[model samples]
Target: MATGDAKLILPFNSAFSSSYWMRWQTPVCFLITVSPGIAAALMLYRLKRRRGCDHLPAAATWAPCFRGVPPLVLPVYRGLVVISMISVLYCLLRLNGLVEFYFYTQWTFLLVIIYFLIGTIISAHGCWVYYRQRRRQGVEEGNRFLTFNRDDNVDNHTALVTADNNSGGKLEDKRAGTWGYCMQIIYQTCGGAVMLTDVVFWCILVPYMSSAHFSVNLVMGCMHSLNLLFLLVDTLLNSMPFPWFRMAYFILWSCTYVIFQWILHACGFSWWPYPFLELATPWAPLWYFCMALIHVPCYGAYWLIVKAKNTYFPRFFPHSYVSL
Candidate 1:
């Protein structure tokens, strides 16, 4: 092949070569993979400081206290930072005539980033509402101050509190406050947005038309199935009270998805959903396999971050009186 042909083939060809796969995937993969470890460290740090702080302050407060700006400001600032970086990179790629390559992958990659940006805004607004309410109640009485001690070993804490206990001995059900209601709305809205986006992308934008010369439905369907499994496991991990049980569930879910993918591939079907995986070369399967491996770790890190935030951040934890 000529040099131009080689240039065209390299990325796909390198996918199958173990050494090349490691070199290109490791940097970003490692950052995403270790995110959970970083989150764990942060969680421990927060726990250590929990005794002195009454209610866990909003993430926004910690951001500014830890840095110079308030924590709420950080997400917006970070979003702008990401936009700036993408803009700079886009310009550089345009100058290099690599912009066309980006267009091919933009449907999925760009949309994923956009979804996160929107989700972050919703989360920030929820945090603001939560913090304002906490401020009104005063810190000492706030629920944020309660911290889980690893050494406590109290099994009774896992018992489900009844509506009566939650109501402070009152028989009537308490009404949730404006902030609490708003937070629930935001959570449901974000979840809906993600589901809608995924539907459009998988069902419409990337659909497998009979004329397209490939089984788009099979590939996309399998990928979406795997994604659903991931989402289910992630939700269970976050909601489950026992950490060990959550870990076990996650492991089992991951293995199931991996096995399903292999079975599909061995049966002569393309199980990878991403459009980039549609190539005919041997490299295509290998690349998808690497991606599947990388996806679990990246998502696990995200789960850890979200779990820690809800546990350590005041805004996410619900209050008893607020319901009234």
Candidate 2:
């Protein structure tokens, strides 16, 4: 039945052609395809209005202020949302037979684009809710730690301070320790490196790999999965206050991914980005297991860096930093 439908929708020669129309039609197709997403967004907006928070803060607003650095939610969301809209447009064009040439060759691209747009929109909405709470409570603008009184001698090291920085006395801005600052720099560096590498791999490497019969959709899926996993871990680590809770969250989330991968693999599917695992000769599950293990060190390094900043450079990493 699927085969008959494929033939009806896509012709033999048109399916395999390599042309500009095939490659570039995605954005136009995505715009037309995003009706469901638009509908969903409108529905959500109406629901929120009905709940009585007319001026509710966006989800990005509640993102934990890492020291003074506002969470990088907006940029990420903007990029993903744009890509998703493009994907939706692409799907619409393909389904409607708007692009005559090479339609079959680009089917996988359509699916990948759709997956990304949907996933990012869902995740971004959750983040929006988080920031809204912070904005409404006024905590979004204050230091996450060390509440102080204006009348107190804030300079005195002997005095204990509240984390909220809202005590009756003037708040003292404590300098972060040298190690903490160093960690912050390292975390930022690592985060940047990971993102840059992933982008390069997707935009450049994947096309080359596809020449060898690599599944682009599969590769994209894996990459997106990895990205989601990393972001989830990073968010928890940076947002949580206590070390124990941070570690616990990391473990729980990591285990969840492990289980998800395992189940998918057992069911004859590969759901992660590191294509090396799927490309292995023996098809060992252990290879995928090891790939996941790499996250431990990556996250561990990130945690160490954040921990150092919090411990050493408290003033530099104030909790009150907000970015629009």
Candidate 3:
């Protein structure tokens, strides 16, 4: 039966000859992959134009909803950084140094690490600002107490106080700038990529498609599980908003990987990391279409998780937790 199965399936190839393009499945598969990518790009463009840069609040980049302090989320982000880096390094060493980075699992894992790294830096800055604000606030209160009811410098003092208050308010309300948005885009992209990577690996690939090229092992298990686990913890502790519009970026991430795989094969590198991604099969179009559509649910699952967090956190921890 194994030999019969091998005989029935088309062998993997590296070169894309003229006949390869001539096949109906080839063009259809290309269309399936390219169409979503184009649509996602346009959707992101329109969203940026319509919502403007300030749509994602700056406070969310640093602050934790469960607590009023912006710095409270720092430890969680730092832990994520350490764990993700160690997991990624272990996978690379266990599999095949740099070559293992070719898998989407590595791509998503690296992306998660990047998000946490950026989050940690931003959180550290938030902590500094938080402490500075506290010190200034104490000094201001002391000054007010000492100068209470003084009429000697009333006008000058009033103007100076007003100016100082305005400056502090502006600083506190600072916008999330370009880097903040970049961090957010990566976070949301990782959300979907993590889900897709795990679901495909555990549900479909493990059951039906496992082989020598894609073996089941501890390293691979951690690659799928830890990505989801870390991100979930982040989602719970961090104040970042998970907007549905950001799903566009996730689609583009997956599409970019597909294009990368296609390019590698065109350059004579045979063997797909995931069998469903092969374009040579007659069912290629179906696989491509299904993969493209799967992004919705994969993304939706994470979005729902965020929604659930926001919904139930306040109810459960009424005193300590607040929704983002």
Candidate 4:
């Protein structure tokens, strides 16, 4: 087939048949479209509003990161922000014409970096404030410091926190101040952003959308792997607590992007950064719906990873810093 003819083919089309749906009108596609929505909804339903961080699970194995950023995790988390910021700047300055600038992969990469930057800044500020407050009060010698969710939760939709008596009454349920709250918002929002960004890039864009001559460069490679890597490392070190319902923020984030794209197209730009986003095709709605549904799983899987790390690590390595 001619190159021009190939370009005209719908993204879902292949060599054997023109339409992928026609070739495989089976249960798999139906499950893929419907399952994520149901699952995400169920997870949201499970979150009950609590008066305080009383419901916040207090596992001896895992520390609550939502309050104050751990002093140790700072370096790795900031390192990711640095790497991502540099990678993005390099791409924008050096490879401007070689890449699709507005593509979701690029957008997500940028978003993750922004998230890290905001989070790191807030954590640093909060930590400084914490120390200054300590010095001002003339208190010293205790390892446990009072922080938000130290014992109480302020959010109306916050889930229950599990108690760990083994903590020897060390964890306090203090209110998260301005900086702490900012960091919490950014941290929770990032839970889904990281997964959604990485999954789409690795599973869809790079494999199917990248052009024939497009080869993975150092930055390209780092951009994909490092986002997830940084978050996982943060998971191991930070005291931020991630709950399942926070995926709602992630959904809203993606929806905002789609709306922005629509607005841009409405103004005059005709190009869609991704072929899956093109509405001219008959299966466009299906594509959109499936993409929406997939968010739940992608987000859920990452949550599970955090939960798994929190659950198993203490049992396996009781003396690790992860064990509060």
Give a tens-digit lDDT track for model 3, residues 1-324: 011112123245555544555677877888899898899899878766875433554556776665443455565666666676776666455445566666788788888888888888777776565556557676554233112233443221111122266465322123577878898999999999999999988899788863744456556677678889878877887778888888989988888998888777766666677778877788888988989999999999999999998888879887757433
Residue-by-residue lDDT tens digits, candidate 1, 38-57: 55456546654766322222
> In model 4, what is the error at residue 59, expressed in angstroms?
15
Q: Write one digit per residue (lDDT tens) for candidate 2, span 25-58.
A: 3333333233333544565466546742222112
Report lDDT (CA) for all predictions. 0.36, 0.37, 0.70, 0.55
Which stretches in model 1 have alpha-carbon errors above 4 Å?
1-77, 89-112, 142-324
Candidate 3 root-mean-square deviation in Å = 8.1
**TM-score of each model, in listed order:** 0.30, 0.32, 0.82, 0.66
lDDT per residue (tens digit) for residues 1-324 in model 4: 011112222122123222332423323434544455466556555543434432332221123333334453564457566676766556543554433445565666666676667666655654564455456444541223433232434432222221335653343434455545545545666767768777776777767754663445556666677777876776766656676667766666676667676555545556566666666566776887778878878888878887888788667765543322
- Candidate that beats the other on TM-score, 1 or 2, i.e. the better one: 2
Q: Count the backbone clashes (under 3 Å) in each candidate.
A: 8, 35, 0, 20
Clashing pairs in 3: none
Query: On lDDT, who's better, 1 or 4?
Result: 4
Ordered by TM-score, highest first, the candidates read 3, 4, 2, 1
lDDT comparing candidate 4 with the true structure = 0.55
